[model samples]
Target: MRRSGATLDFDVDTTSGHPLYIPNGDLLTANKWHHVVFTWDGNVTGTNAKWYVNGVNKTLANIAGSGSRTSDSGYSPYIGALCSGCYFNGQIDEVRIYNRALSAEEIKRLYLLGN
Candidate 1:
């Protein structure tokens, strides 16, 4: 996650690699409430990855890299901030991780529940 003034660039790292990187611009703003969802099924390519904001599918955005993910980084996921110097400008509510990719319906329900 990177925030500069009014620009916010979000990235959803996949075990396969860095298949998710939302460019800096309109998809995400500087200050606002949002619910982000990223899903990638097992052994999938970058094109198969999916991400959403507020239940709206944003997977249409450009996703870099290709090929299947054979393994995940041994490191644990660090959200909101990649490191001490890279703290997210805003706040985060909650984060949940599942062993399997959630269906679109499930993601939408989560968004509805938040609202």
Candidate 2:
């Protein structure tokens, strides 16, 4: 997912041939900092993925299709933006990527730390 200005974008492509795309919405306030966290279990089902904005879980009502969440050899993680475009306009700090999925409590702690 990526954000441009206040608009947020979400996308998912499963080898099932059907891809999932979420509607664009305001995920950030102008000139204000926000804490955002995204997580996925690498599970085959999309149900295990999550989006956390300011420590609260956001709904993913638009998600559809089914496929493994296992890492794809074609894609690598990008911290501030997508490969083609949708570059972020603000500062990104203390970015972290983990090999293991973090628990809810750990997410909360990290969010609280503002790191």
Candidate 3:
């Protein structure tokens, strides 16, 4: 994902296939900080993945596929942005990754903690 002026770009993906790129819309405002959390459980129905912004659930409705991320991806996860020369133009703080997906309440708690 990326930040462009007042909008936040979003893309959902799994271990395989093309990424599900979501168009820029609500869930973000300009000149403010937001707590963003992405949770994916890999199920096709009944909440397979979610996107939370500022402790509110803002996951898009039309998720394309059964987004399943593999346990191991060979390369290590990189914070801030991707490695292939795609740099983030905005600031990032308190980034975290877990071996398992976090629940909504847990994400909200972390958001309230601010790190």
Overall lDDT per candidate, in order of appearance: 0.64, 0.66, 0.61
Would you estimate the TM-scores of all the predictions? 0.70, 0.72, 0.66
TM-score of 1: 0.70
Worst 10 residues of 2 by lDDT: 17-26
- Best candidate (score: TM-score): 2
lDDT tens digits, residue span 25-72, model 1: 466665678888777664334455666788877644455655555444
- Could you tell me the TM-score of candidate 3? 0.66
Q: Sort the candidates on TM-score, descending order.
A: 2, 1, 3
Of candidate 1, the 10-residue stretch with the lowest lDDT total is: 3-12
Kindly report the root-mean-square deviation of model 3 from the true structure over all alpha carbons: 3.7
**Residue 38, candidate 2: how far off, in angstroms?**
0.8
Q: Model 2: how far is 28 from its true place, Å? A: 1.4
Order the candidate numbers by lDDT, best to worst: 2, 1, 3
